[model samples]
Target: MTPPIDHAPTTEARMLEIVFPDHTNHLGTLFGGTALAWMDKAAFIAASRYSRRTVVTARSEQVDFKLPIKQGQLVETIARVVEVGRTSMQVEVELIAEDLLSGDRELCTRGRFVMIALDSRGRPAQVQALPGSAS
Candidate 1:
């Protein structure tokens, strides 16, 4: 028989979004809150895909914005599970901004989010650990 649904390693997550005028500030750069929302979405995708369960963000670590994302820049966010507990998982998220014209990319944001799995009753629930995780 095939292994169960939760018997696999987590698939890494990558999301891409373009910085538009609507998402920018008077300085013509992406707003900090918008960037953070993208990072949080990336983390949620990673966690939900891994556990295949309803997950919610418990907290996010200090976010660092290394570079600015200007209008028309492409932002790519990558997320991976770095740690796990009985009911929580820590996802490391990194956002990169690229100037498509020049093909230059820089790390723009970095943060770690703690996501908690929830049962049908909305209480903490155990998540199946990654196959080879030390947890």
Candidate 2:
């Protein structure tokens, strides 16, 4: 079962967006680029929150568009920090689409983002090590 959107555990971030006409493609579905952008933002937030430091996206991987989100639907992007290394974290992001009228929802997209924590001088800095990770 899917967890509630408002339930954010540690190392997790959740964001919601309404799909307007401007965010849609010519076919009236949410634009792929826009979805990716949102997913990246969520990943950034999760990584930053998990490490409590500045973080930057180093890579996005295995992005899969499972379903199309139509305009006027609501999109929830949930990001969680799943793995952490010395200075890098892997965030798993999922985009779920909900019909505003019927309250139906589906998982539309998913991706993994790698973020590197940065020091004040903009160099990679150590992040809090996960329990099983090599610090």
Candidate 3:
């Protein structure tokens, strides 16, 4: 069976937006890349907030696309810190697309991102858990 969804406290914050024509495909659906970009942005924000230092994407888990997001839909991206090491933070991100007019939401994509904290010199630096962070 699929593992239970983790409902732990997220490290960073949540972001939402309504998909417009600029973010849509020729078929009038949100493109996968658009969603992926948003996920990455959300992950970066979370990691930066947790590390208190500049962070860079070290790796990205393969994205699984579950449904198509239509134009004029509201897209919500949730990102949470799942694991923290000496200098690396693992962020789990999920993108959900909702039709505000119809109140329909779908899981558009999910992925994990590994980010490494950077020092002032732009080199990998040690990271500490932020205040109010869940252990």
RMSD of each: 4.2, 5.0, 8.0
lDDT of 3 by residue, 1-135 (tens): 999997544486599989889999899988888888899999999998777799999999978888888888899999988888889999999988888978888888889999999999999999876456684
Taking all chains together, each candidate's TM-score versus the true structure is 0.89, 0.90, 0.85
Candidate 1 per-residue lDDT over residues 23-135, each given as its tens digit: 99999999999998999998999999888889999999988888888999999999998888999999999999899999999998899999999999999999887677886
Candidate 1 global lDDT: 0.90
Position 57, candidate 3: lDDT:
96
lDDT string for model 2 (1-135, tens) is 988786557699999999999999999999999999999999999998888899999999999999999999999999989999889999999999999899999999999999999999999999887766665
Candidate 3 similarity to native, TM-score: 0.85
After aligning candidate 1 to the native by TM-score, how far in Å is the CA of 35 from where it should be? 0.5
How far in Å is the alpha carbon of 99 misplaced in model 1? 1.0
